[model samples]
Target: MSTQTEHPPAGGGAAGVAEPGQSAAPGATPRQTLTLLTVLLAVFVVPTSISGTAVALPDIGADTHATLVPLQWVVNAFNVAFACFTLAWGSVADIIGRVRAFGLGAGIYAVASLASALASNVIMLDVARALAGVGGAAIFSCGSAILSTVFDGPARGKAFALFGTVAGIGVGIGPSLSGVLVQGVGWRWVFALHTLALGLVLLALPVIARRTTEPRRQGARIDVLGSVLFILAMLLLTTAIVQGSQWGWASAGVLSLFAGTLVALALFAAVEKRRDHPMLDLSVLANGRYLALCLVPVAASFGFVTMLTYLPSYLTAVSGYSSGTAGLIMVLLTLPVFACPMLAAKLVARGVSALTLIYVSLGCLVVGDATLTLFGQNVALMAVAVPMLVTGAGMGLSAGLVDGQALEIVAPEKAGMAAGFLNTLRLGSEAIAVAIYGSLLATVLASRMRDGIGDFPGAGDPATVANEVAGGNMTGPASAVDASARGDFTDFLVRSYDSAFHTILWVLTGICLVLFLIIGALVRTSRDGREPSAATGSQAAG
Candidate 1:
């Protein structure tokens, strides 16, 4: 069969095969249409969840009286849980049945959102957000599996394309919709919005489940120990980042969290080495070309997703936009994601190399991030248009291409692990990037607060005020100022935030450029020194 027509055979996948009742027909049936829509709906929401809630952070902090440290959890917990549990959920789907897993995940997500909506404390909201993340993991992992069983051949490709598109749309619209929800209905309504959509998914679950089936993994043991260790490592690492800001970075508690993360990761490696069915096949890391390719999404995570998480806060706080306006402006950054994946694919087909497109993307990210320093307290839509579009385009170009291209060079048996690891790195890096950025921003804001503003009566603590300001609660500083100096104080705060924002963006630019040099050389040198596979899509792309 041509590569385009190929589809998986029975018992042919790591996730499991479609069972007896499942159709292998080439065209879509009403049942299949329903299944596809159901799966796509779930797919849409997961990425939306990842991107949306960041816009509501200011409201969340103000309402809950949380500082930036715990407030960071509102975003990090979701990313951490979703990234850590993704592969494990795939294993669970194979055992419990994909449809059952899908329904269960949707249920968990709905309940968690309800809890998030009702939570009066930031801690309660953070925990619920993490639960939503776990549910999101199952939704995407098994949602893909379910789609495979319901559609066949050409339609399968279309289904997956739509799957990716809907996901992008979800991400593209999440901030804006979330902003509107926060602005009009209040931040709690953001979680309530998810509850409403997911509730409908649950209503259709029984019908969706009846239309498909997959064989159970009779004796398959999930690498539970490996999963646990990975989760521990991620949780510890993110905790350290958030805490290093609130506590001194050199504090023993912060140091201990860092130490604990390293130990957990070391143990995870040891556990994976001994597992019969390791969640990750470590051997793939040796392929320098493959490793280099995986950095495509890493670049996107650091360059683009971090903006998704932080920029709304920036626009609202430093740029003096309302949350709704900030969300609308963010459309410039997210819109490219909706269309660029297909454009990249078409360019590749037209004889442009995927690796070239990847390099171009890195260029866009570095240039865009650096140029985005144009944003100031008087930010105009026109001033940010070019940079936001460039950054969004950079991310959009590589969203799905990297996965397929990365898998092509490795042995077929390793593809699943290769993919699982690639995505984990992508997501894990995103979570860390958000934490690291927030931590850096917090540190900068604090220093400026103490030095630039000086100590004023009723100012509270400089560090506490910085934390509050970072969470978009400028009232902390405002409360300290006399009415006459209030205008000057707010202006100074904006300047402080602008400087910090610029510093972070420049640092991120340096990281992107350094990575491009390192990975670009690795791909070129490694490809020349290594044997060419029957698949040199890497070479052609390189």
Candidate 2:
């Protein structure tokens, strides 16, 4: 375990404002206020960048001539890199210094965003996105560490709450900003705009650097082998899941990837269990409270990401809305997300359990998804927006609680590992959700359309006809078919989409229900979710 010590004051004034990681003098102004804003801005930038790109994806596809699968990779590649590199960066922050690592990440992120503005093809765009993930990982890994160092007790709680709000708000505001950017300028300008803000953040780093001094650690060894094994496992598993539908679940390529993932994970476990300073601390997984908290974020975030991918399609296809209008509706789903962290913070102060808040938020997710599933096409805009608001709020409130809970189980020295583990679980869960839901929806829609049109009179080879229409190959000879045939095919496709959409909702509902059960089984109740072990000088177990 790492021992923390206070730095002797080099001078006075705001520069000596407790110097982060130290007790303050009487009437001292806490650094929490400044640190909160800085960390919030850093944290918000990543998600905002993600959402911004998402809203402009159609334009990107058109400009770069990217197919749907390529488009999926453009998003998935960044996620993969972020998931893989996060733990390594977290450990690096612990070894070198948080501020240095943070600045490095910001520099990389800025450069990557700028590079993406000039991408001429999907391949180039994906590379830029991957680099952006590397930067994002650095920011995410160190931001919380900085917060932990700067604030204590109630102030720390507020700081973390503010951090969560920034993240949630970034997600909420991303698409809207992207839409406006695309409308005002070209799509390329959207990527270009990030550099301006990033540049300002970069220039401000020196001031932040002077305020805090990080004490160097001795004999800190990074588990290079463990990190490699972990990344390999994640990559293989994600590849298997994401490509399984297109490749066929039983195909040799998919099966081999699945097998490889299992083998790598088993090896990773053995290696970590034996390592002196493993990339992740396996023992934390044994902590019931931490494990329970992990489940909520994985489940909720999974559901949320799926909504990000499919909601727009649903809006434009079934609700007779334009893509821009669909993007606007998505804002309603994300709007509550921004407010959730603040709400949770207040609730926590009033003696609420993090688990309790997570449960309530997850419950709202269930209700919202269920309502959407049941009446998506039939519901009025107001009706749909209400449930969406509730769902978004729930996700926002619970987003950062998982990290806090995970941190509680480990000793202070292992905070980086705990954070890394939680992040890994989250990324892995998100990938799985995207693959599973996507495959299920595709299959159900196709099957439903086939069945809906099967018994119609003179409808020979309905399956072939349906496949052609769904694949966007309706032109050529297919279009030369009679008007009645075209109308029947259109009706079948629409009905299939509706059925599939409903099926997806029901499936998500079941997942949420299971998540609710998992939460009840795992979390031990606490007042305001604080252990008081670190806040006070109480002994936390080894």
| TM-scores, one per candidate | 0.78, 0.85
Superposition-based RMSD of candidate 1 using all C-alpha atoms, in angstroms: 5.5
Q: lDDT scores for all predictions?
A: 0.74, 0.69
How many collisions per candidate?
A: 0, 0
Residue 309's C-alpha lDDT in candidate 1? 79
The TM-score of candidate 1 is 0.78
The digit string of per-residue lDDT tens for model 2 on 293-339 reads: 66777777656777866777767666667876887888888877777
C-alpha lDDT of candidate 2 relative to the true structure: 0.69
Question: Model 1: how far is 330 from its true place, Å?
Answer: 1.7
